[model samples]
Target: MSRRLEEILSNPEMQYLINNANNIENIQKYLPILSELAKKVKKHNTWFIEGLARCRVPYKDIEKYIDLDEILIDNCSIVGNIEIIRQLRNQKQDYQDYYVSSVIDIVCKTSEKTLEQTNKIEEYLTEKKYKYRFLPPDIYVIEFKSPNIKIPNQFGVYRYIDTEIEKQNLRIYFLIAAENNIIIRRNSIIEVVYIENFALFSLLFKFYRYTEKDKKDLEKYEKSREGLEKIIDKGFHEKDLEKIMKIFGKEERDKIMKKIKSYVDSHPDTIYKKLLELNIWFYRAY
Candidate 1:
């Protein structure tokens, strides 16, 4: 066994939990041990969350989850929640990174699509004597694989192992283990798609690549409101309506118009520009 594996195996608290697998209550009894283990393995420089998952210690403490999250998010190059695309406009950008921007395409739990394939993957792992375990909802970890095999060049890190029938190149790691089938490499291109999973409570995946055009558009939108704010601050000029309509799309213009109507009914002398300014500020405040 590698030194890393030895360290995990030799952990007295971890051994206690594994040996007492017959009793699920041991998890709560030994959470502090598990939290300590999480801190130790966190600096491994990968997102595997390795040792904690390896020992199958289910931590139930919300604070412990927050503590672990602080470690992972700090180290990740980029991270984002999985949500409806339409909701993104209203959601604030929650991110911290050392690099510019890149969106990584990730496909997870796709193996669960068909029962037959899921069984096949389990059988494959058994045949290879792979050390692996399932973390609730969908995360599956492959702990032990044949050593000394060369991993692909573009592969930044192996985050998770999933059952993928069709092989595709993704910046995110997805591997289905087989004898003499470990080698993998493919075209590194980016495409955006949205998939649904209601089981997860919050954001699960991280997007790595953001195109120049995408970044420019986001920057433009952020700065776009400033000029419009200035125009609205002056007075209700006829040209102000034209300017506000051009800055935002139909939905936004409709909102502006509705607010303007309400404001006109209340303050007859106030300009339509005041309504437009309030509408823009309302969304920005979020």
Candidate 2:
């Protein structure tokens, strides 16, 4: 990774939330992304973390990380409930003649408990040496990718805070890399979800992990067989192939694309089924 990407991923505040993620529900009400991000952490070998929502001052070259003292999942939940109450009390009824009946909308639909998924993800990533970044709380958590903590600079959120929930309004500036750098704005109401609503996040995480693992394993095995063949045909012998494949670096696998195609032709179809599912090749050559 480049230094800028690394620095962003290793930002202390984001890392702290990942390192010490909270599982308790109430605290999630406070900093809800904990649970949502926890699940994400469990899914892919991507992303970084961030924290300290209340502090508005931006630090330049902040040598240290900013984070909550503890997981605070439960505390955040309590904060969410409080915010709800505040919203109810602050409802506007400008005129007795013009009072209109309206249904209250949930600012965040996720339960505080589910928000801990972020912590789990952090634990998983730290173990794998992957990277992530928690965009400043001012930024919305939008456009979640499998195994990543990326937010486009353009995904706009209403971007405010409700003191009771300590939940800041997040309008995700989710955009494709193509749309990120340019400066035109879209006013359409794009559906947005906050960390407070962590339901089903686990499912997304599980699917992502399963897919990533499959990709890695397929690449590793295909590369192994390729090396074995080279041993038989080239200068090296079978013994050399055995030794080399055994010492393969535990990497996510790429450069071995042709090795995978080889399996489709010369090896048993079952051995290559998983790779076929991953779409590693645009079309499997016979």
Candidate 3:
């Protein structure tokens, strides 16, 4: 068995909980063990939580351990236990955090429609309250948090931006996760969408073929290839290119720009298609 499965089974209490998930008496007897498993085996804790929900354990009992958003999303199905669903709905309504509330709203609303298809998720995004954009397959939402916020243990790519509002700078971040959820924090965000699991070599080859040019100059700046690819993926913004130039120095910047301009001039159609792809991936987050 896989190490993760073994770890779950190794804990006899956890194993009992999973086995008797539909038994409310058993869940209540080992309730404290659920919290311990949540802390110890975080990656697989969802299984235990799902069991609790399925068995109709009180939401308040599980709320202290598992995240509300996680439980709601993981078990947001009409087939899911109705009492647990009602408890989660009440909990969601009581949340004052805008991001959390909005996320719950999106998931609950979309789940009402259908959770089995991507197109169904896209269909209900027309609501004015939360303007969610439809991301293509393999593209994911990346959330950012302002530095002033005291959110701890947050993880993602980090980028800094300068703003004139109050003469203070903000440290923006890009939170990449395995879900297609939108997370907004106090109206401060940098960029939202990125190519999921981007393959550098494959993108480079596509770039070369699109430009219909030799790879000599591209290979010359081996160190800058990744940076260049990022710029292109983000739709060849001048500011992004300038940032790359600032990091790699002016000479390398000029060469990179020259190569890109040559490609744009030579293959306008190809470049336009790329920009369209970017537009479809990125939407205004409000």
Candidate 4:
């Protein structure tokens, strides 16, 4: 077998399909189309293939009706198979919502130990006139939506903590809330699960549409931070400082560096503390 075909066969999802197939020989004929789909999706494309299988699309003619574009548009035309494909497409959309809701359910379940406490805390917050809402239990957990944090066109679970709350009770109130929430940030799918004492953050999916400006901005931001740290340790004469400041452009270079140096000298710990603060803000905002 060719290297690419071998790679596809070795994929865990593909292996599962192969090992469980009623006739392995029938699967072989579909490999070329699967390979092409995988290339288009930049992954195993198991979900698409499985959808076809579930619809009972014929192995010999699967490629004739279904292509990446048709799959994307949910407009595949299969003779005498239109109804099944239509149903599958509807299920595919519903499945996305179902999948997100399931993840939120699992995340909420992790905090079951603190649910009673959370309810009590919520009551207290309510009495104190804090702004919040409790979603239907079937859909999501109690949500303490802070007016302080808002991101347009995104939905996520957020933990709200009032500094006035007693430190002992703070842990109980730290609960994430939102059902079927997913963050789609600039062509990337960001999945974040936060329980009382657990957290999982990952870039779950990418659409590969990063622009040149985005890449340059990210690179410049990272390099500038690294350069600032070196300047803090080794002083203004640091050799690479000039190169790093050039990223900011000639007009703002000297003024910006001077301002940064002044702040660093006066409050050396601010940088570290600000990073932690930003993380907290991100968790609350998203």
Q: Of the candidates shown, which would achieve the greatest TM-score relative to the real structure?
A: 1
Q: How would you encode candidate 4's per-residue C-alpha lDDT over 133-230 as one tens digit per residue?
A: 54321121111132121112123333333222232222111224332233323323333232221110110000012245423322222333433333
Query: 1 or 2, which is superior by TM-score?
Result: 1
Worst 10 residues of 2 by lDDT: 174-183
Q: Please, what is the whole-model Cα lDDT of each candidate in the order they appear?
A: 0.30, 0.29, 0.29, 0.29
Error of 1 at 216 (Å): 5.6
Q: Which digits, one per residue and each the tens of the lDDT, describe model 2 over residues 1-286?
A: 3344445447664465433322222332323333333344344344333322333121111101211122223312212211222222223221112211121112223433233433433454355333434433323333335334444222222112122111222211101111011111122122233322121121112223436653443333333344322222223233422332332222312323344455456556434434433332222221
Q: Against the true structure, candidate 4 has what lDDT?
A: 0.29
Local lDDT at 221 for model 4: 28
Put the candidates in TM-score order, highest first: 1, 4, 2, 3
Q: In the order shown, what is each candidate's alpha-carbon RMSD?
A: 19.9, 24.5, 22.5, 24.1
Q: On residues 155-242, what C-alpha lDDT tens digit does candidate 3 reach at each position?
A: 1221111111122221111111222222222222221222212222223333434343334323322334344334345443444333
Off by over 4 Å in 2: 1-114, 119-217, 222-263, 274-286
Residue 75 error for model 3, in Å? 27
Candidate 1 lowest-lDDT run of ten = 198-207
